[model samples]
Target chain A: MVSAQPAGFGHDTRHELIRFENVSKTFELSDRTVRAVENVNLSVARGEFVVLVGPSGCGKSTLLNMAAGLFHPTSGEVYYNGSLVDGYNLKTGYMTQNDHLLPWRDVVGNISTPLEIRGLARGTREARVEQLIDLVGLQGFERSYPSQLSGGMRKRTALARLLAYDPETLLLDEPFAALDAQLRLNMQIELLRISRSLNKTILFVTHDLDEAVALSDRSVVFSPRPGHIRHIADTPLPRDRNLTTLRHDPLYTRMTAELWDLIMPTLQETRGEAS
Target chain B: MTNAEIGYAPASDEKVAEDRKRRMDKARQARTRERVKLNLIRLLMIGGFFALWEFASGRLIAPFFISAPSAIFRRLGGWIWSGDIFYHMGITATEACAGLLLGSVFGIVVGTILGRRPFLARLLDPIITTFYSLPKVALAPLFILWIGIGMDMKITFTAAIVFFLVFLNTYTGVRNVSRELISILYLMGANEMQVLRRVVLPSAITWVFAGLRISVPYSLIGAIVGELMASNKGLGALLVRAQGEFDTAGVFAALVAIMVLAVIFNTAVRLLERRLMPWKSAEQELEGAV
Candidate 1:
């Protein structure tokens, strides 16, 4: 059960970093109105990794955008640290599905952009960039431009850049969706390790049920367009779970199965419409 | 064992080495032959063109108007021998280069300002369109009347022509930057100026270079047309003088000089593009392949 916290105050302010209080979003096009999400209430605790899985066009990304302060909810409010997020939230970093790496800059240049914006000293920036490059397994590609990099390598650069300014929370929208299966698994493992080590809160959006189970402390499933939360299940796996061995864990399997079962009819309806 | 004894054993490394060497030699020979064939065809084409021109000038048309290629080359050689062409060339070059530099700098500054201020850009869109629609070359005479029949008029006209071309491209380039990228930067705590410097400017540079590349010939045309209308010096003046005297060879010589200058200017911009935006070139190649 989710409790409706007050707009300005929460009982446990220390743990709850991001709160959506009955948030809804609608787009008013020229001829029609599209209700993207409806009356969704959720809270992400400090250092918690939460994933949202739903059917296509189910407004998972919209939810993340609201948390990032890039979009305002139609009716309710999104709160960050017990304050209404009215403008751009500086405490969080957003990584979209597209790498959005500055095409003109090389890997090191792109990764160090946030530091440069903050006017960090040259030496310190270089050192931090070097560490991130090493962390992302992009040591040899520091001087290579984004256009020259493969999809997975570009994703790694994006991840490094997102971590550059050390935002307390990460808002990622299917960052690894473009990667191959093996690379996706590797990135997931790396992400889990990094999140645990840094203790950063993360709100991830993905359509993949298995990824939701493998990456998140809790998985939230939603119905199709005008999306609302259908089920919220905590992963039964341990905190230090390995991505490679997650499929074999009974809890991971059961959690993914439960999520799939909840969203199956929506997915089939979308598929039927497409066909 | 019996088959090996009858010379059916595995081949020695020396035989494989010989085969590889022969293949490489054959490939080299083929490449040389291809180069020679291409060169020969090019030579034939040029020679045939000149021979045909010579025949047609005397038979099909008046030799007075369409001077033969030999006469054109002779006039070109005479200009080189006398050194008068250099002075005229230097004047035109100064006008074109100065106008190009000044106009590009001005265009980039104004375009960037307008691009960042969407309110101003929308307000002035119609006025900008009207100015752009006015025949720029037709204003050369007006510039001559205001600035006098000197190099100043030509330079100003050239700069005016280059300005519009670069401005529109730079503005579009800035406006075309992805909204998603801007939002990401904002979430990263980038203020307006930081966003402009780190994202908008660098992203617009490729378009700026493209505009520069296209403006080279227009800049030359602007200068030459201004000179032809009323100027004491420049290749365009030389052409006008030759036309008045009915020296077709001199006219051809001046035209050829302009062509050569255009080629040099184009090559310089291309080289600068390669050096300055190496990433863009690589990106273009990837897009081409896709």
Candidate 2:
């Protein structure tokens, strides 16, 4: 029944921001079909930081796409704010793996793109873009093109651009996958800071175990291939989280090991099936 | 609000910055000197070629068969002195300009439309390829027959040639546009028209400029070919008349004029390219390429 929602069977429907109604997506190719995700029943409550953790090819990104209204479930429905998401959802901002920053645009221009698209006044757009640039610490790099920016700087610019339109929710799909370890760690810290300051609902997708455990209020662990929500575990880490120090915390280490235990079997099963 | 709030790169050794500037200056000066030397060598090579041609025209070969550069220069001078070249050049330039504008618009539009519709493009690909393969010059006679041997025929023929050159370039541009970029914008609640303007147009314009660079010269050539095939007013007609009279120098002079026309068209396109795609750094552009 529609009332029987995951983690919220008795809770009021008003608090639920997004709900997946028995969602399944089967992508048909010329010769075969790829069942990307199956029977994905989930509910993201308002202001909840839900991180989807899975191995590559697990359709974690597809779930994010479904939430953003880029794709519809082949079998079921995706409801956002009590309405079916039939088209591109305006309430969410998606930061894809690729920065997707317009190469022709400088830092300022790329940050101001969403505002410009929304047809905001020139002065208002400029003021907002300036504020975002400052927020993301891209002050001196305003004139620099994406090509001229460092990898870390480019990711920061993307973060600012995502914040430019001021969406209520953020769907970040493998946003820091390409960054080096140090940069990735720094961005993870930056994301936590930004997400806290803005209090935005974030549906973060990453394969990285540490990232999932470090950032999420509730970490949704997924199995390989046809992605199934294997475990929905609460992170229960302190709100004032410093990742550098938190990585060594007793709870952080234990959560990560538990997540790996849940994930390790799927990897072995995939290998078994392949062989 | 303050820089101290975020991680800083720290002062990157002022001496390193100064040294970098100095090396850049030296490199620029070295490049300037090399260019000067290159120009000097080119001048010598051209002068030697002319000297050989001048001597050989009368001594080793018949001046009738191979007109001297001096004779071509005289013919050009005569055209310049009489101001008769203005008449022919003005017509040719007009045809080329008209053709460029009309063809570029059609090319950009058709190419962009095709780019957005994958199935429609796939259905039309075979016919489109066939048309693209059809040599544009082969259409001159048909265009002349249909439109008649006037400015109309020349302009139409020129536009036909330009369309293909620009069409493929823009189509390729549209194809290469990042789909993820469009998806990102769509997620931001940008409409189809806004996506077209913000993502598609900017991505395709770079290719349009490339197409224009290649198309500008062809546009002029198309006009000239049309004129040569029929028309009695343009510079192509002048070349034909010279050939009829066995005026080798006149033929050479006409060719020289066409080269000059091509240079002018290319320079104009370059200027326009500078204006439209200012994001493309001039230093990143090929130093002396068309």
Candidate 3:
């Protein structure tokens, strides 16, 4: 198998950008305790696009939250760039299912939040914001509030806001699941383009097998509740790929089918439990 | 040539334009007729109310006790002509405004603090509720004893009344802020103060405005009750004095003045809300459409 390595890459051994060392998280509910994730060990390489796929309530989001330092693992530690993460992982940008855009702020204002927090100069911030607006195709909506934008447009604005901080790593949680199919495809393509150009390390969580196969260099499948890594598979598809024509690729089809096979039992188990 | 070829057939574009115009005209006429009917009914209802009040005053009810609408109007006119009504109005307005400003500031500050700190909010919940349950009017006599029978007593009473209402609403508003948004802000490297200013305050502002709207009338009620209990100034004092002298018309006139004051305060608060939250109007319109 030919290893698809871009030029001027693959020599550095310090590729571990984010690492979870025997991490586990448990939530204490009012009446009982729920073990969300159990003894999960995962590592994301620098500039690697990794996707986490699992059934509902599988602690996929919990794993990402641990990486972002929003939630501390109960027993073990999460490390970023070889440093223990005690508080918020400032080097990473996190996006959840909800856009979480400030409704009071206009598009530019929302996108410029991180810059303002960092106390960037007015001219520089405005210039960067304008560039992002163009990049996200939200040029004419600079002054429109979140309520005024369409669902797809709001998601784009959120992406722009996430990028504004220029974090080295991104933690995205089903960011495109709320969008319709066409819009979702468009966003996925845009995300891939941006991720490549920026060369960001991404740990994305999604329930869609096709999305995972299409976007990631390595896809991690998680088991249902008390989530553990069930399988970690490397995509055979080349890095230079077109998202629109991805499904037609034989290799892409096989990868998605394999993922579906791996996740179907857990999905059925959940259905069984519900019934 | 056939008749169709000789241009005797109706022109399609002209006919369509004429039909559209006729439909629009009919719609406009119907709207105008409906509006006229509505206004006529409203006027008749108001006229009928006054006529009945006049008819019942001296026959079914005693004029000396209930007083006639004409007599109340005459008393009001006399006060206005003498310019004594303005003095009473000025005093009441001052007390209410002072109390509202002070109460709102205190409420927002304390409410925000308590809202941000769940432990503190929970700790004080029982005590706060106990105080909140106490009728604010009952405090008027206590305020008079402490502050003495002047504008200070009325202002203090009004502030106490307005404070509790505003505080509860602001607290709920802050608590109800979106957890997702707060988490996002924290991930963005915002400290506690930044999160409060940039996210929490803005998110809770609508609830704060709602509280402000509700507190305006309560502020007036507090001031008037304080004055009625014991004061030498304000419209409430005037009403008390009129009752003592058996001037039923003067008492009715004072009540009318208080109603006008409520309307004015409500209008001012609405204007302030519009100015502060321009985004809320768009949000409301979206909600209305949905």
- C-alpha TM-scores of all predictions: 0.89, 0.89, 0.89
What are the lDDT figures for the candidates, one per model? 0.85, 0.83, 0.85
Q: What is the C-alpha lDDT profile of model 1 across B85-125, one tens digit per residue?
A: 88888889999998998889888888888988899999999
DockQ for each candidate?
Answer: 0.30, 0.39, 0.25
Pick the DockQ winner. 2
Q: What are the iRMS values of all candidates?
A: 14.3, 4.2, 15.1
TM-score: which candidate is best? 1
Residue-by-residue lDDT tens digits, candidate 2, B143-209: 8678889898888888888898888889889988898899889988889898888899899898989
Model 2, A87-119: lDDT tens digits are 889899998788899988888999999999889
Docking class of 3: acceptable
User: Across residues A83-200, which tens digit of lDDT does each residue of candidate 3 receive?
Assistant: 9998788888888888889999999999999999888999999999999987776766788778767777788899999999988999999999998786687678778878888899
Error of 1 at B282 (Å): 1.9
lDDT of 1: 0.85
Query: Any residue pairs clashing in model 1, and if so which?
Result: none
Local accuracy of candidate 3 as per-residue lDDT tens digits, B1-290: 22233232223323433454465566667778999999999999999998999899999999888898999999999999999999998999999999998898899999999999999999999999999999988887787778798898888888998899889989999999998788888888889988999899999999998999999999899888888888878999999999999999889999999999999999999999988887776575454232
Query: What DockQ would candidate 1 receive versus the native complex?
Result: 0.30
